[model samples]
Structures are given as structure tokens and as C-alpha cells.
Target: MPGLLALVGGDEFKPGNEEQDRLMVAAAGAGPAYVVPTAAARQGPDQAVAHATEWFAGLGLALRELPVLRRSDAMKASLADEAGRGGFFYLSGGDPGLVAQVLRDSPVWRAMFGAWRAGAVLAGSSAGSMALCSHTLVRATWPNRFRRRAMEALGAVPHTAVLPHYDTFGHKWVESAREAAPDLTLLGIDERSAAVWHDGRWRAAGPGAITVAKGAKMTRFESGAEVKGLRQPARMLPGR
Candidate 1:
């Protein structure tokens, strides 16, 4: 069976996001939800874990922390083993480029794929969400302007790119993202909102909306709305 995947905008472990959190737990059934704070490691993994723990506790689900912070940690057999047993695996928000670099071709990442294929819910927020796409948009700041560049990602979803926090700074990056990769479909997800992949398509969940942009046409989808034409193509990253 194909596993469930959720790409969230941001503000994951806060209030007002209870509904989507519950839905994710429900998708996983009866098992602990693994929290991967690799992206937030630079800021502080402990804080991120604490927040996720409290948030999941409100939903009556256990949150397990997988502290795969560095590239070496990603190669640890112990971490990989723990990651393989989760019912729901959540990737917290932080630096998207760093997340992609640490997990790319790592043992822990391979374990995550195996676990998800065997029936686990895989969820990512902000940078986490961006790292899962075939192409990732890395934002840079100069003396007077901000720049958006495209980079290689895990390719869990092929020919696709995600812009998290769309209700805020994400919207501004949409056009730049399109210009960077015109052939790829761009998804702008609002903060506290999610776009979940299930039943062969993506569906909007949570309070905010999801915007799908292709070429010059852009469409918006609200909660419970199904987003069509996001199927995985033949150009998916190897071993995806």
C-alpha cells in the first residue's frame, strides 16, 4: 500500500492545528509518532521536541524523537532502526537546504522510505516539506534584496516543488520559483495548512488554503478540496 504524506506550511506544533494533527495520527493508527528535528538542529532540537511532544500529547498520541542532527548521525544504525519502526514520521521546520544535505543518500533516509512504504504516515513542515520535493527553493539574502534559487531535493514527489508559509513570505517566492523551474508544478501552502497525498492525489487539510501553479495558470484549493494533476512522473528521483 502507498503511504500517506503531508506537506505543511509552518507553525506545526502550535494551537489551531489540532485538526490536522489528529488526522495525521489517525492515519498512522496505533503507534508512536516519530519527530525528526534535523532541520531545527541549529536552533535547538530539544525545544522543537518539547513543542512537538506537547502538541501530540493533546491529540493523545506519543511523540518519539529521532535526533539525527548530523550527517554522521544519519548513518547510525541505531537511528535508522528507530526510524524504521515509526507509525508516523514528522520532519520539523527549519533550514530546508540543510535538511536536504544531511539526509540525502543517508541510511536514515533509506530507512524512512522503507518504513513509509510498509504503511507509515510521513509528514513534513516548512523546510521539511520543501526537502521532500524533486526540486527545492533555497532562499538567500543579499545586502538589499532576497534571492530564490533551486536545488536538488529528496524527490519523494517528482516534478514538484513546495513553497511553505505561502500566506506570508511564500507567496512572494512563487513567481521566482516558477522562473527557476518552469517545467515543475509549484505548490504554495499556507501556514497552519497542509496538502496531504492520498488515494492517488493531493487534498487540502487544515485552516489555510493551497495554491497550485503551473505555467501561467494558478488555482487555489481550500480544506477538503482535491488537487488534481500532481501524480508522480517517470522522472522521479532514483530509489523514490
Candidate 2:
């Protein structure tokens, strides 16, 4: 069996979300739970790791911080080898576009994929979550020409775009995204919440909820509720 996959909305490593992290730690087992801060490269990756370090410690799990801050670092053989030591791996928050750009087809990502296939828990929060999917919405930055758009991703979880931090301002961003591409499925996940894959079904984890809307019909799943009929994404199992 492939291990757990957590797609956290935003506000990762925060206190209220311990319910999901506890499950991750339990599933992770003895090996180190590596934290890859690649997405936070421009936004103080070290500080994010430090924050995560304190948070995971409280959960009694020590994290191996993988400092793959740039695309160059993602290709390193040394880091790739080190990544295999992880029983659980987390891709923290930052730029969705950069995370996908850096890690896709890289040696370190291959190792991480191998680990996840061997039953290691692979979790990603916010930008990390978006990059894990087949397509993701890139947040506006840089210049007027570089506002935002849907970009292709790694496809660990296929065929969807996530709107993180949904309970608040994240919902506001979705309108522009929906208008830009009306066909795409937007999974609006609330902050401090996560959509988790387990036991052949999707579960609404943590304090907040997961919302899926189709036309005028909107559906919401509260915490611990089973998300019925939600499209199940491909897993990193041993065989297809």
C-alpha cells in the first residue's frame, strides 16, 4: 500500500491542525520526516523550517530539513540520496509555479517518489499541495505580464486545481481563476484544514472543511466527514 497523502490548504504547522499531523507521524514510522522548503526559497525557507521544526517537535517527530531552495539544488545527487532517508516528506508553502518548476523530473523528486511508493507519507501544504496536482493556479507576482494562470504540475494527484486558504481570502482568488478557466475543478480547501486520502476514500481532516462546487450546486464536507464522489487521484502505489 502507498502511504498517506495530505493536501493541506494553508496555515501549515500551525496548532489547530495537529489532528492531521498526528496521523502523519503515526503513519511515518521510524525514519525521518523530511521537510523540503523549496517553495519558500525566496520567502525565507530557513525561517519556515525553523517554525516547522518547533511545530513537529511538539508532535514528537524530528524532521530532516532538505534545503533544496532552488532548481539547481533539486538536481543534486547528494540531496537525492539524502531524500531517500525520509519515511515521511513534506513540501512546505511558497510559490506554486517555482515548486513545480524545480522538483519535476529532478533526481531528488525521483527519490521522494520512490520513498512514497514504498509507503512513506507524502504531505504538502498550500503551494506544496497545489504543485502536487496535475494543474495548479500560480499566484500573481513579478510584473503585470506575470499576473497568474493555471500551470501544469507533477501529477502525484491528478486532474485538479486547489484553492488554498479557502475559508477566508483564498475564496476571493477563486473567482478570477474560475472565470479564466471555467472548466477546471477548483477544490476550495479552508485554512487549517486538509483533504486526506485514506482507506480508499477522501476525508475532510482538521477543524475546517472542503468545498466542491458544480454550477449553482455547492457541497461542503465538515471535519471527519467522508467526501463522497470526489474524484480519486492516482496514488504512488507499487504498481498501476
* lDDT digits (tens) for residues 1-240 of candidate 2: 677888899999888989888988888845678888988999999988998888999998898798888889989999999887679899999888888899887888878877876788888998999888777788555553223578887677766778888898677666667765566667778988999887677899999999875544568999999976456766542223
Give the TM-scores of the predictions, in the order they appear: 0.93, 0.90
Clashes of each: 0, 0
Which candidate tops TM-score?
A: 1
| Candidate 2 segments whose C-alpha is farther than 4 A from its true place | 140-148, 214-216, 235-240
Candidate 2 has a TM-score of: 0.90
| Model 1 per-residue lDDT tens digits across residues 147-228 | 5778888778888888899998888887778778899998899999998986567899989999999988999999999977
What candidate 1 gets wrong by more than 4 Å, as runs, is 29-31, 140-146, 233-240
CA lDDT scores, all candidates in order: 0.83, 0.81
Cα distance off (Å), candidate 2, residue 93: 0.9
Residue 180, candidate 1: C-alpha displacement in angstroms: 1.6
What's model 1's overall lDDT? Answer: 0.83
Model 1, position 33: C-alpha lDDT score: 72
lDDT of 2: 0.81
Highest lDDT: which candidate?
Answer: 1
